[model samples]
Target: MAAAIAARLFPGRIYVASAGVRRGSADPFAVAVMEEKGLDIRAHRPHTFEDLEDMNFDLVITLAPEAHHRALELTRYYAVDVEYWPTADPSATAGSREQILASYRNVRDGLEKRIKERLGWTPPVSA
Candidate 1:
């Protein structure tokens, strides 16, 4: 959802990417929930921090607390802004499919709202 909002708000102005502390496949439940907001996650495959070492970014935002620790540890060697966003772990929620999907939607909506509140605005014109 963050990626989707960033994609919409910034378009070609910013490069937005997401990776996990550990490598894994993209969660289907996540894809479903994101689709509710018209964001497609079908092609988004999960990656590890190691896959992200070559590039530089202005800010590194971590959604999960565990990811916050890992990002801080990583950025200590480099210089970048690390912002921790405490978000719920939808995967940890227990219930039926609809219940689980509701959890995902809540997380997705929260992320979308936060992203908009944080960065949704007109970009400054470049000289």
Candidate 2:
């Protein structure tokens, strides 16, 4: 969700890679929420930190403690910045269909805001 938002908000401005300590398929709820934002993340594959060793990253914003720790470990060998945003794991939220989707939507919206603010991006005026 964060990666997709950042990419859309700041296309050529920076290179963005999304990696975790563990790899898993993109969350369906996350994909659905992003689609509501007009961004298709169905093809976004989850990757681990090791999966991107050959790639260089300027900054890594981790939403979970485990990721932050792993990214800090990455800093031991690579010159990169990591920031922890302490985001809520929407998947952990328990509720009905609409209520559950609300959780995903909240995460999606929060990530969009943070990505815009942290990366200093403002949408171009639509003419």
Candidate 3:
């Protein structure tokens, strides 16, 4: 979701990739919520940090503690800025479809806000 949001908001400004310590399929709820904001992440494939061929990122933002630890360990040999952004795991929420969707939406919105704020970006003007 962060990657999708960053791509949407920033366009060609930066290279953004989202990976984790573990690999899994992209969550359906995540795709749905992001689609609500006009970002299609339905085709996104979750990748592990090892899948990344480029370890020369100027900044690495980890949304979870385990990821932060993994990123630190992986980037220890290189000079890269690692930031831990403790984001909630919306998948942990168990409830009805609407309730679950709400949780995903919350995460999606929060990520969008954080990406913009952290990157010091303003929405592109639509003409």
Report lDDT (Cα) of residue 18, candidate 1: 82
lDDT for each of the candidates?
A: 0.81, 0.87, 0.89
What TM-score number comes out for model 1?
0.86
Best model number under TM-score: 3
lDDT tens digits, residue span 42-119, model 1: 888778777875647778888988888887877787778889888888999998999999999888888877777777
Span of 10 residues, lowest total lDDT, candidate 2: 51-60
Which residue pairs of candidate 2 clash? none
37-110 in candidate 3: lDDT tens per residue? 88888788999999998897889999999999999999998888999988989999999999999998988888
Q: Using TM-score as the measure, what is the rank order of every candidate, best first?
A: 3, 2, 1
A best-first ranking of the candidates according to their lDDT comes to: 3, 2, 1
Clashing pairs in 3: none
Query: For every model shown, what is its TM-score relative to the native structure?
Result: 0.86, 0.93, 0.94
Model 3 gets an lDDT of 0.89
**What TM-score does candidate 3 get on C-alpha atoms?**
0.94
What is candidate 2's CA lDDT for residue 65? Answer: 98
Q: What RMSD does model 3 have? A: 1.2
